[model samples]
Target: MPTIASSNFPTPKSWDEFEDICLSVIKVKCKSTNFNRYGRAGQKQNGVDITGKDHFGFSIGVQCKNTLNLLTEKIIEDEIVKAESFAPRLSTLYIATTRPPDAPLQSFIQKI
Candidate 1:
């Protein structure tokens, strides 16, 4: 099984390694759901760890944080902003972390 890692979270690793984990998770999730998906790593124009199109043809932007620690609201906000900047072109934005966010951060994400 693939896993995510980060300096701030669990075990720190290179960005490329984290990117790989993110891509793996997306692939597994999409495959399990029988969704046709396509992905790219660090595509310059995308400004995200991974970008993909689902079975329904909607574009998605994903940011992965490998840290074991809880994700912060600011980090989520920044990723959202980055996703929005790439918007209408991308239908949904997702921030995936190795560890879940704190209660406050989770609430913030729900509102975003």
Candidate 2:
């Protein structure tokens, strides 16, 4: 993971804050990165929080969440579908959250 320098603490208080943090990390990790939100600060993000190209030129889409709760199967499924719709097409989809995925979620991610 890339190091993120922020004025705010690591624990983001809002979803937008979490997204910003994820963007920062992505910017450091990828060859190039873009925050995909438009309109107001809390507007719908159209599924992607950050998009970038890795060092190897693979496109990636990232969705950020600031929840302590486990990511439910339904939620992951929905996010996966959303990521598939991202423009320019992504070679990889990553969910950036403070809490790590549980065993089943980890397995699901690995399989995908």
Candidate 3:
């Protein structure tokens, strides 16, 4: 597989900035302008950083992970567990991360 051009874009300086970027991208891709940041800092967010209905009018949740290293299965699983409680019952959950495309990780996520 071709490698991702990580140098093509600037990494976010903080978690908040990362989430903001993810929010913007989701808005454009999903064609929905009603999304908002899910929760304040230091609060339980049910694993969602940004959320709202998508273009299909389905409830969507996004979790922005700003980790520099690879995302562990445990981390993903834990977040999914938390997200299970999000109200309105999210029709879809997106895990947006800075981590590169790892085949194993991708496989694991796909199985979910």
Candidate 4:
């Protein structure tokens, strides 16, 4: 795979399309990625966009944010908190954003 900084992945046309890309990525990276029933935009999603079991059968939650603006600490933190309240619970929470996390945000996530 190409380095994330220089990845050739095409930009998604919309937020929903970005979520689909994230789901596809999760499927390729794992073996059991599943899109939530409420994954569609404008749905009453409880926070998670995708859910799946890891190789160890641990549930994982994915939230995708497709935006050109840089991510903020508050946004990332909020997503983490929301994922925590999702049903069935998740062993991990992932935020797939168009822009990579800044250093501070990355550190914060690593410390979680």
Q: What is the TM-score of each candidate against the true structure?
A: 0.66, 0.73, 0.91, 0.81
**Which pairs clash in model 1?**
9-67, 9-68, 9-69, 10-68
Q: Which candidate number maximizes lDDT?
A: 3
Worst 10 residues of 2 by lDDT: 1-10
- Cα error, candidate 1, residue 39 (Å): 12
Candidate 2, superposed: residue stretches over 4 Å from native? 1-10, 33-44
- Colliding pairs, model 4: none
Q: Give the Å error, residue 14, model 2.
A: 1.0
| Model 3, total clashes | 0
* lDDT per residue (tens digit) for residues 1-112 in model 3: 4454534567789988999899999999899998999879999899899999988899999999998685899999998998999997999999999886788988999999
The list of candidate 3 runs beyond 4 A from truth reads: 1-7
lDDT of 4 by residue, 1-112 (tens): 6797676666689877887778888887777645443456577556688888877788888878887576777888778778878878888888888874477767877887
Off by over 4 Å in 1: 1-12, 32-47
Tell me how candidate 1 scores on lDDT.
0.65
Single out the weakest 10-residue window by summed lDDT for candidate 4.
Answer: 32-41
Better of 2 and 3 by TM-score: 3
Deviation of model 4 at 83, angstroms = 1.2
lDDT of 2 at 64: 76
* Residue 54 in model 3: lDDT: 87
